[model samples]
Target: DAGVTQSPTHLIKTRGQHVTLRCSPISGHKSVSWYQQVLGQGPQFIFQYYEKEERGRGNFPDRFSARQFPNYSSELNVNALLLGDSALYLCASSTNSQGRYEQYFGPGTRLTVT
Candidate 1:
């Protein structure tokens, strides 16, 4: 079975620019969640999409948004990126069986804002 994966291991952008990060969930998984990990901080939930329906979101500004597709893939978009927005974006996926939350994570896409 394939594990979760993300693209563009690293990126750099100036203030006000926008970026989109991609993620692919493991086979047989229907739940995907997005998280942002800033320097020296734990991963904070950005969005959780199950069956292409949003399940949850965290305390982020309007500049942050995301969506899940039919194929179970997802994309996270950040608009008007700020220096504070520079962080490692992580994508996790897990089975929806009862009491399962030990999500598997992919190497995050690290975004650096100048």
Candidate 2:
């Protein structure tokens, strides 16, 4: 099977603009997560959708949002972009069978807000 995959490997946006990043999970996975990684810092968890319902969220502002599809794919959307939003948007996939979840991450989409 394949690992998680992200689209538009790179992106650029401006302040006040909106952007969307896409993700596809590994086959048979039922959960997906979004993360943001800034330079010199660890990745910060953003959102997690299990079975198409939001299961978790981080301290991000309301400008950040995400959704999962019935096929297990997912999307991360950001509105009213700010320079601080520029970072590598990562997508991860996992499965929870016995209260344990392991995640596989994609390379990430690099978004630069100008």
Candidate 3:
């Protein structure tokens, strides 16, 4: 089956513009999460959804938001973008069967705000 998929492998925007990134999880999986990775930094959790419910979120401003669909797909929406928002937006998916969960990441959507 297909792994995680994200759109617009890269992105560029100006300050204050809104951007929405999309993600589709692997087949038969029900957990998806969004993360932001800056230069030389690790991916920081933004939001996590499981079974169509919000499971967790990260230390981000109100400008960051996300949602998960019934088909296990997800979207990350950032509004009133700022310079600090420039980073690689990653989408991760995993199954809910094992005791430990390992995420499978997409290539990421690089958001650059100038």
Candidate 4:
């Protein structure tokens, strides 16, 4: 079966622009999450959606948001892009939110701010 998949793979934008990253979870998965990974740092959890509801969020600003669909796919939207926002946006999927199951991650969407 296919794992989590992200679109565009790469993106470029200027400061103050808006960007949307997409993800499609594996088959039969119900929970989707988003993360941001900056160079030399670990991945930071951004949002987690279960059954189309927001379950968790990190310390990111209001400009970051995400949503899951009925099919378990998701989209992460970042507004007012900044140089600091340039990083790899990763999407992960799991069978549940209890952390009992292993989560699978996508290759990630690389965002670059010029």
lDDT of each: 0.94, 0.95, 0.93, 0.94
Instruction: Report the CA-based lDDT of candidate 2 relative to the real structure.
Output: 0.95
Clash pairs of candidate 3?
none
| Model 1 C-alpha lDDT versus the unseen true structure | 0.94
Query: How many collisions between residues are there in candidate 4?
Result: 0
Report model 2's TM-score to 2 decimal places. Answer: 0.96
Which ten residues in a row are the worst by lDDT in model 1? 94-103
- At residue 103, candidate 3 shows an lDDT of 86
Q: Residue 97: error of model 1 in Å? A: 1.2
How far is 43's C-alpha from truth in model 1 (Å)? Answer: 0.7
List the pairs of residues colliding in candidate 2.
Answer: none
lDDT of 4 at 17: 98
Residue 113's C-alpha lDDT in candidate 4?
97
Off by over 4 Å in 2: none
Clashes per prediction? Answer: 0, 0, 0, 0
Candidate 4: give the clashing pairs: none
Enumerate residue pairs that collide in model 1. none
Q: Which stretches of candidate 1 lie over 4 Å from their true place?
A: none
